[model samples]
Target: PAGDGKVTTPTGVTASKVTSGAVVLNWQPSTLTTGDGPIAYKVWSNGQLVATSMGTSVAVSSLLPGQNYTFSVQGYSGTHASAQSAPVSTTTAAAPAQKPVRSAYFDQWGIYENAYYPKNVDTSGAAGKLDVIHYAFANIDPTKLTCFEAVKASDSANESNPNAGDGAGDAYADYQSDYNSGTSVDGSADTWEQPLKGNFNQLRQLKAKYPNLRFTISIGGWTYSKYFSDAAATDASRKTFVSSCIDMFLKGNLPTGVAGDASGGAASAAGIFDGVDIDWEYPGSAGGHTGNHYSPADKQNYTLLLKEFRTQLDALGAAQGKRYILSAALPSGQDKIAQLETDKIGAYLDYADVMSYDMHGSWDAKGPTNHQDPLHDSPADPTTPIAPGTRKYNVDTTLAAYTTGLPEYGIPGGFPANKIVLGIPFYWRGWTGVPAGSNYGLYQSATGPTAAKPLSQEAGLAAWKELNPPAAQTHWDPVTESSWFYDGTNFWTGDTPQAVQARGAYAKSKGLGGLFAFSLENDDASGTMLNSMDGSLR
Candidate 1:
């Protein structure tokens, strides 16, 4: 008599009831030849001969846990060999656990000299929520104390001056003192300010308090961006400037005794500055101080410069067994995109902070000051049109600028969703010329037509309540998805707690990292704005 000539086990042979040292393999029986007696079978483990079997079921013992093993069976037709079934392998399940996610941001002027300490850090009572805080080092007087003290003194002097000093006087004085002064403490030489006094030292304290928090020194902003063009014009200058910056930042040798730690100074420096952020305002555009005459080489050379920085920092980190980060704050316009080779630059960057605010303002001709980012509608409505190209400000425009503006950048990790902190203005914009009954009225500055006029939080809230009280009036702008109180004369452009809630929802929907208010002091003392942001974002 001949045994079955073919072995026909079901596809996907699986093992069930598997334990630490045993497994149960199950499969349908194979067909036997018409004249052959019930075909005998032999089950092999890992394709090796293991044991002969007469039934379809088999329980293998002494198997290792979590080990993958293949199994197959063979049939016999008398003395002739039959085909073997396909092999099946089983794998053990891995233990369950959650992976960690990293977060960072491009904070606007986070390390101001006088205001960068824990005293100003409200923390919303939720300290340690941030993993990385990128301080935009705008207006650093390497020759003078950081710009914070100067700005504070300027503010005080202006408040006391006959004409309040205005903008020109303070700016000129600061420029002269910062650049012309040869004094050691004038901030000419690079040195760490007294402990917890200057921005850098305050940052050191912040890092110490929040062990996981990291800091980055960002260079460049709207006013002082002119130097970047000059520095990048020549290879020698670029190398020299970048090298000096790295050395001053890392070694603190220029102005001795300013560094946070003297013992293991190199390690201390490494600990304080995890990276550097380049905030070249409008690299290729005419706007800001970066100069309007950059050639095509500037764009290409910018990438090379960043690459050089990354290479040098990485070399240092490797030598010291520590890791350093690299990032940049990109312009918020399409014209400036050419200044950076986004694709090449993205590879070397840890994150890119996109300035999504300041897209519209009094710079445009209009009566109502709309939201910086409107969720819907154009700046000017078609029905009661006031100006051309004026619409509600919203994230859609910002996202479009980054996506279509720098498509080649590939923007590793989806436009830095978490790193893409939304810029919220603590102050509001206003104007005259609106109708008496318009909903946009709140308070107007009689002394000045510019948005620089200071508006107190209490006064602003009181005026809004008196004019368009929260109960009677819900400051709603369908066009901007923002609310404002029109007190008949001035058109106040400020955000409410409700508007902030909507912004938080929008940020979450867009997968943004967090929200950053322009100036912390402008918020209500009770911290209505900050608390709202914390609740929504945290």
Candidate 2:
């Protein structure tokens, strides 16, 4: 019992990370005799004991923003308590001017032709502003009917193959491919010994640099969603598919490299993805890419599939002590939304990201060169012979279809507004052979999509940074909250910087979850659109 009341004073105490609501205070373990049983730590804030920790660090949370505080540590062994360590003073960050769920989609193929690497997420300043990055995409196994990460792409050319997504993935770009100093996030060339490489490795680095940011592996897309219906068809299939996804992405059991490369193995990409984003395109409808399987049962089955995912993810999270996220890219068309149990599925999702863009594009190709991503409908627009997307094809109306229960149209039960994420397209849809009208090609007859040289990244489309229309005539439609440009014959429907900022303000005004770019790479090098979105949201 001699000197039982005294222990070694804690040392090397410091505040490692300070934020608006929390401070991460860390200290070295005290040196003492083995007789000191069951050592512990006590955190003192402003000279008062605030918390007891079994570890060397404590996250002192729920503090006032922009306030200064002093943190110290004391070691404990049984009834003995060490003298308090020297206090270290620090200030919590000022309150952030934005909300959570600020997300952006990262296209892995950007490395192929667009030269957009994960490093761009950093240099563009998008990483700092974004809290979530949905990496698009991780493909589903065609034969296995499960989530897969491989290097074999069915259509290597990446042309007009509707089934290009089946069993197709870029493991090369995901992890195996090497990043030179110029292309890497940390400006370090990847060596052979490193287990990870390429975009995925860059993502890991970005995650380290931006501790607040999280990366989610987006499963399926317009091009890669061919098998969602089959995968989510029944209970057995859904269980297998979700488990495979958890194994491949959430668990990171990636393939051991593509073809004959031996640089990769299981768990090579573990801890990279924070969750999964289901981009199934459409559930019960025969929409999206060709040969997509759909059935009348998909309506109920879709909700069931999501429940399976939520149940499994929660189980895994409980075991791992982490809350993994689950979200989906909701169909914008009212008809497509009808096939989804929107009201029910929202309960299983962190947020439902509405594909609000591409409302009108060259895909119509019939006549009117229209706004592809209007925020509202124009009263002067054609009112007769309306189709699903022909009318009410705007951000406001599409989101309304989910949150307001369009009873007149038969879709019932509304989703929560706070759980919706708006989509912002970083690319423009163009058309040519348009007869000049008072609306600058809008609501005017057009022959077809533009014959002009399209952006190499996609066909009949132009990236936001590559829009050029002969010094172009520009116009904005205040009624619809849309903007575009034309040069006599070429018409391109795109969003302006102000338009993007307005959308951000619109999200805040409506109490929406957050905003996401269709693909961050298409934005200008200045990240003007993303910055505008963040600035207004703030």
Candidate 3:
């Protein structure tokens, strides 16, 4: 031991990221010649040794929030401890508001043809307080196996020139059209010459006004999920599909011809979206669209696909210097849930958007006139056969199934409760020509819709706008915590404001992530349903 032989101290110590109860400390490793061994680091915080690491950075957690702390790192060679590195002082952030996520699925098609544009949304109500907005649909090309196509819809109004299918491009509604209104989030009109225009541009402006709102492009819905099984059939195919999605949404790679014109070019819509959502209807079974490819292998491949998506998204996020989210819209039916490897697949997703509403609908061969989106089970009979369209199906059961019924492959049991987000319906499933009774034909045998409601254009289905029954006609089922209305011949069943509040409260209580409705456009212009959801969380 020589007089000038004091171990050289580490330097440049800093706490780069400080959260409520964690800090990531970084410091230059020590450079010294001591008789001991290899160099190691001892992270000291407030005079207490918190961690030991061989690397330059260490994450320290369980620290008190809203408190000042000084951190220093000491280099150790063998048994000799060098003088501590320069201390870095930092104050932890206050504990964040533990508010559950409140999300809404916005349908892009509703903007133009339905006359329910973004400008018509009541920002003061539920629409304004949303945490996440999932823009409905980016379809996978069944043939090309690359790119997400826009919502190409037909103009049913023009009989002579019904818009022909043109490669699924809907730029005019997405980010092209100018919807000038007093309720513009920025109180400004689109220049009409901007590269990006419609609801996308409107969404960008809205996000600027409300910085915390997150928007994700939801890929796949009932009508457009014909290619998911094939896309995820093999690792190579999955990678191809995933890369294509990232390029289209995250990298803003627009398709040539139709969609390309709207996107302007690559990366044009890059920053507009925070992530991509997979809405692969039913993975191992039939989804919303006909001719969907499916197989028993889909169960396993589904998990692999999700893992790949997570891997690619994480890589992209790392390269882009930001976090990206990966989520999925999952089926609510227990039978359908069993078909997929959900316990494993869910691990890669941010949350499982359980389509808890459509548990029962007119798609059934026949129905007992049950509510489509009940909050809880009403019939207590265990032996009662719970048909696809029966009263036994409820939101509570769906939530429980995702969080506890299925074991996570040695993860004790059941899906992680926190990763489950209860999905509520924003519309009603209607049945016509029902026999009127004391319960007004609820749970009674009836002939399903004789014809589709003209406005909704879907047989046995009606949106909130098309199926608003009188207040006196509505009835509440206490056991199930659901509401239904039967105007003698027409039986409509869906969520009421009270039922939505009940479900939201249930989600909060169960430690679930949050709630996401099937759609925002289905709510009233006053944002009544959205407000009801807001009030429940409050």
Candidate 4:
């Protein structure tokens, strides 16, 4: 044996089992004895000493995620040291993106005037990250009491909507209207011969591009829920409703009379729709669109309706060899959710994304400005004068209403957290004519909602891309966890990027499924709100 007290160098140094923050290294033990006790191994990362081990393998911990590291191993026995093993390099894995599903509503009407299209989802890069895209406002046939597709031009000044019970929807936007190459998902113009030419075809293109994408035809939104009560009224009604929906959306049976060169009929839109999202504004509440039908039986019938959809969807899935999604756009208002059998309806849903925004809006026309989407209730809120001292009109209370029901509120606390997705709004809720108070307009009185926006934008309402109140006028409330704007006259409330990241953090912390927005059109041209959501929900 060599008298030099050094041990022979270890060979075959290797790095494996790498993660975002750690990596494991292994090597053949030094074969030659140093003529001193035993040998221990030293591990180095990026040329810095990091770990020591008695065995041939050592694991390096506390490394940065997605970092590139170069590691080497050395063995020593007593005062003697072996030459370093050959180094190996590796890049730590990137951290997992948001574990919860990220979903959003695609307002079909956004195409008419907002000029948003299914192609926007692709161009904005939302398609690559989204879990579900709920195509909003598929109508319920009032006469047949079933799901159907049709379009009727809207009348803003009219509250007594003639289309309230007429199975009215923008079918022209759904699959009938043509998308030119510039506005189409694949840069190809939709032709007359194509059975499906509009948003449905563009969605199909987006779907093909993103394998994980799911498109659900959302039936019974705020405007179209007028006939939901009739559709979900009884066992027979539920069966008829669920079957018609499955056939119309999942099975792609477009009504033949949609006004476009696109001839519509059986199987015209098959494979474009993954499932259905039930958005009956309220099962037994009076707060929906003015004439929406409601009955006390809606609570039980809501659960039964979900059950019927689940059963029928499962049966169809068995035949098609694919699982179809079934979700509901849940209400956030305590009173509205109270009308639902939260404990029961959850059993049949793949997801129940809470519409957590719109807690307060211009509807309270008289005064007392409010933050529409508070993550938590503010002690500073003036709502006590409006109603109870309780702070029940925020995001936390809404999520808890389902995932961990509030017993005091009659909500049963046991729905699975991972199945629930939180909703974020991409629009600002505002009001005007406020008296400049000590807090500007934090909760001051206002004569009414703001002036009506042009292009038919709702009065006192603005999309995320529209509002840019001055920095001097902006305010953030940490107690309520919200941000707002007030220039001593016009008061506005909405989700800033910081507020959005906070909500994403909230979703992860609560073990919830993910986050969604009320609309795709409300996002800034850069998709600021949507991008913030995608990056932070992890």
Best by TM-score: 2
TM-score of each: 0.58, 0.81, 0.75, 0.79
lDDT of each: 0.47, 0.75, 0.69, 0.76
The residue-by-residue lDDT of candidate 3 on 261-320, one tens digit each, is: 433443345455677788887787854444567888988888898899899988866543
User: How many angstroms is residue 2 displaced in model 2 relative to the true structure, after the best TM-score fit?
Assistant: 35
Candidate 2 residue lDDT tens string, 416-532: 999899888888888888888877777887778875443444445888888833334778888887888888888888777767887888888889998888889888788888898
Candidate 3 residue pairs in backbone clash = 175-197, 175-198, 176-197, 176-198, 406-414, 407-414
lDDT for model 3, on a 0 to 1 scale?
Answer: 0.69
Better of 2 and 3 by lDDT: 2
- Over 4 Å off in model 4, which ranges? 1-98, 156-165, 260-262, 385-391
Candidate 3 structure, TM-score to reference = 0.75
Over 1-538, each residue of candidate 4 has an lDDT whose tens digit, in order, gives 1224367877888874676655667789875452435455566555444545445654454345677778777766544567777779988787666467889999887887788888888888888778789988777777898877666754534556645435456778877787887998767776665456678777766754564577888987777787888888889988988999888877776777665444456555665677789998888988887777899999998889999999998887655434578999989887787788877877899988888888888889876888888888777677752122244588778777777787666777567888888888888888898887877788888888887665336787888777855678888888877888887789988888888898899888888899898888888667889999998775
Backbone clashes under 3 angstroms, per model: 27, 0, 6, 2
Model 4 TM-score (2 dp): 0.79
lDDT of 2 at 259: 61
lDDT of 4 at 49: 49
Model 1 lDDT tens row, 280-392: 76565566542223455777777776777788777755543345667676765444654566546766776666665554444444533444445555535422321223222
Model 1, position 359, has a per-residue lDDT of 48
